[model samples]
Target: MSIDLSIDLPGLHLKNPIMPASGCFGFGREYSAFYHLDQLGAIMMKAATGTERFGNPTPRVAETASGMLNAIGLQNPGVDKIIAEEVPFLAKYDTCIIANIAGSTIEEYETVAAAFNQTSDVHALELNISCPNVKEGGIQFGTDPDMAAEVTARVKAASNHPVYVKLSPNVSDIVAMAKAVEKAGADGLTMINTLTGMQIHLPSRKPLLANRTGGLSGAAIKPVAIRMIYEVSQHVSIPIIGMGGICNAEDVLEFLLAGASAVAVGTANFQNPFVCPEIIEALPNVLAQYGFSSVQDAIGKGVSVYE
Candidate 1:
């Protein structure tokens, strides 16, 4: 039996429910060499800010047990450069382009969102309000319900593309955050953006990362991601693009069963640059093994059965 792997989200029509998570996939230049970019679903470009950022200092990344911590600081070549240079390059491919927009303030978020209006190649905007590696703007707006809603509303007004808020797992109530963004006119959600964590160097007796704390990713965070998606999906009506610790096709199916309409491959990209395509290739077989005829059939399957 041929299982259908296509998925339709707010602004994305994916051939398969596997796309590289923002920050991990960069601009798809390097990965394009590995395989044809069109073979996969969408590409979530690295986080873009209103201005070009140099990011954090060295030793910004440290490996932990079954995971890694990063404090990259949303480094990028400003929104203008991305639209002029990077966007067009990726646009050459048949895959959907989702711009991951970040900011240090509400106005900066608005500025970046407005900048994307110049490009028609970008299918959606993944609002980076949940970046834990940064010290300001992102996490502040992400954790507070009112602030999350306000930024979502502002970005919605500023951009023509569909807006999907990336939610912080660091919040006390992930469900509350989801509801706030949905009410603010968010088109969809990208859940469980890295849990805030830190690592220590035994030799120096200090923090491992230069920024002290970083957002953790890799296999370790999959359970937390699944739980958050499951909890939030039950409370909200908007679609979820689940992420965090997704390394294989089984993980993708798990996310779908837990309530995600689609899933993004993050740290796994670092391990295997071709992980996205690999997952996409394996998805149909995995779904059939679980008795699912299509990707949509698996979505919220676990939630409905348990509830």
Candidate 2:
């Protein structure tokens, strides 16, 4: 039986539910050499700020048990360069483009959002208010409900593209953050943006990462991601782009069952550059094996079964 893998979110129509999570996929230049970019669903570009950011110092990444810690500090070439250079390159493909917008202040967020208004290739904006590696802006707005809502509202007012807030797993209540953003007019959500973690170098007797703490991703965070998606989906009406520790097709089906309409592959991309296409190829068979006829059919199934 042929299975349907397409998924329709707020402003994204994905051929399949697999897209590389932002930051991990960069701007898709390197991955283009691995396979055809159009074969995947959407491409969530690396975080873009109002100005070009050099990011944090070296020793910014470290490996852990079943996962890795990263404090890349939202490095990027700023919004202007991205729209002029990156978007054009991605437009060559037939897939959707989602820009990950980040800023150190509300005005910066607004500035970046407004800049995207000049371009039509970008399908949606992933408001990155949840980056834990950074010392300011991201995590501050992400953890506070009122601040999250305010930034969401400001970005919505500034950009024409659909706004999807990336929520931090570091928050005390993930559902509260989801509701605040939704009420503030967010189009959708990208949940569980990596839990804040750290590693120590036994030789130095100090933190492993240069920034002392970093966002953790890989197979280790999958269960936490699934639980957050399941809980938040029950409380909010907006669609969610679930991510964290997604390494295979089975993981994609699990995220859909939990409540995500679509899923983003993050750290897995680092392990296997072709992981997104690989999972997309394996999704249909995996869905059929579990009795799912389509990607949409699996969404929220886990929540409904308990309800």
Candidate 3:
């Protein structure tokens, strides 16, 4: 089943369907040193906050069964610094740059989006609402459908740039929240943000993360991500960026087959900074094996339906 990997993420066009998830890829200059940035479909930059954040303590990350727990606290150098520094460096890269923006308050989200809207380099803006690793309010915006829509509506109105609300998998019913955002005018969606979890030290009996609960990501959360993708895809017409445990070409195929128009390599990058390019190169072979012609032809093929 040869598949067509060419996909149009609404307003953004891409040569392939694979992207390097934010945070995990840094500013992309290092990744570019290893491979041509043009080789990637898109680059979702690390989640940037309205104000510069120093992040969390040293023991911020803990390893889970098939996943990893993180309490990075949205450590970013602030929107102004990012636009002044990272944005300029990112513009040099050939791939599309989707700035993942976060804020401690609703007004901050609007401010960040409005600030980025005047820029010419960014292809899209990914709202970081599901940042479960934070201490204050990032996750609060995503846990409730109303707050999710409120944030999306504010950001959407603030910026004309393509808006993609990254949905958190920690919610009780992501479908309702996704539907709310979509109805409130979100340009697109990125399903299955890290799941909230915690780990305890054996002898100390204390939480591994100083913040206690953190978001869980990596290979362990792939199933949960796919499930969210399946449910959200069924309810929304906008494109979906499926990510979580995606590691290789096979995982890419699973996401598309499950209904994701594109896939982002998150924690997998820590293990293989070369994963994005590898997936792009391996996709053709995987398509051949599946008898699909393009990535679009493969989406939603495996979703179960009693109807």
> Which parts of model 1 have CA positions greater than 4 angstroms off?
none
Worst 10 residues of 1 by lDDT: 298-307
lDDT of 3 by residue, 190-257 (tens): 87788899999999999998989888999999998888898888899999988989999999888987
How would you encode candidate 2's per-residue C-alpha lDDT over 133-222 as one tens digit per residue?
777799999999999999999999999999999999997788889999999999999988989998889999999998999999999999
Name every residue pair that clashes in candidate 1.
none
Q: What local lDDT does model 2 show for residue 44?
A: 96
User: Which digits, one per residue and each the tens of the lDDT, describe model 1 over residues 49-105?
Assistant: 999999999798899999999999998999999999999999999999999999999
Q: Candidate 1 lDDT (Cα, whole model)?
A: 0.93
User: lDDT scores for all predictions?
Assistant: 0.93, 0.94, 0.87
lDDT order, best first, reads 2, 1, 3
2 versus 3: better TM-score goes to: 2
The RMSD (Cα, Å) of candidate 2 is: 0.7
**Backbone clashes in each candidate structure, one number apiece?**
0, 0, 14
Residue 106 error, candidate 1, Å: 0.6
TM-score for model 3?
0.96
